[model samples]
Target: MQRNRSKRYRAAAQQVDRAKAYSLPEAVSTLKKFPPTKFDQTVTVSFRLGVDPKQSDQMVRGTCPLPHGSGKQVRVLVFAEGESAQAAREAGAEF
Candidate 1:
């Protein structure tokens, strides 16, 4: 079933070419064309996959490490011993 969208959303959707696949640079450039808004806006991208997301073998997992840490203190559980523990400590892990 189709969900109702705001007139603003419908207008924005019309700006995009539904048939086109955009590169990251192209997507960023397209976003720049939109007029400024009073409130903060969040952008979300969704991709429908052909494979079953529930299947263990088809599960997607990845990590994006921050360059300068998250600013908040991180709590870590260690399962290392000897040199491995020392190496983790040297890599900015606090005890």
Candidate 2:
């Protein structure tokens, strides 16, 4: 389903030449020209994977740590058993 864009959005989009591929610096410069909005605009991306949902083997799930922190607080949990658990407690870990 296609939805029509607002006149403001269309007008802003028209100012740029679609055929031209912008370098990183050029793209950043172009974006800086846009008028500031009342609230910060959030950008998101979505991908459709070619996988059968019914097949367990086709399911995908995992975590990828960022080289730089993601600007969000994270909670880490480690399971320590037997001697390892005692060592962790002695190391001042919260129970």
- Which candidate gets the maximum lDDT versus the true structure? 1
Instruction: Write candidate 1's Cα lDDT for 1-95 as tens digits.
Output: 99998777777788899899888788889888876667899788766667787999998778888787777987665679999998888887775
Go through the candidates in order and give each one's C-alpha lDDT: 0.81, 0.73
Model 1 gets an lDDT of 0.81
Q: Flag regions of model 2 displaced more than 4 Å.
A: 1-3, 42-68, 76-95
* lDDT tens digits by residue: candidate 2, 36-94: 66787853433567888789999878899878778886544558899988887777666
Error of 1 at 40 (Å): 0.8
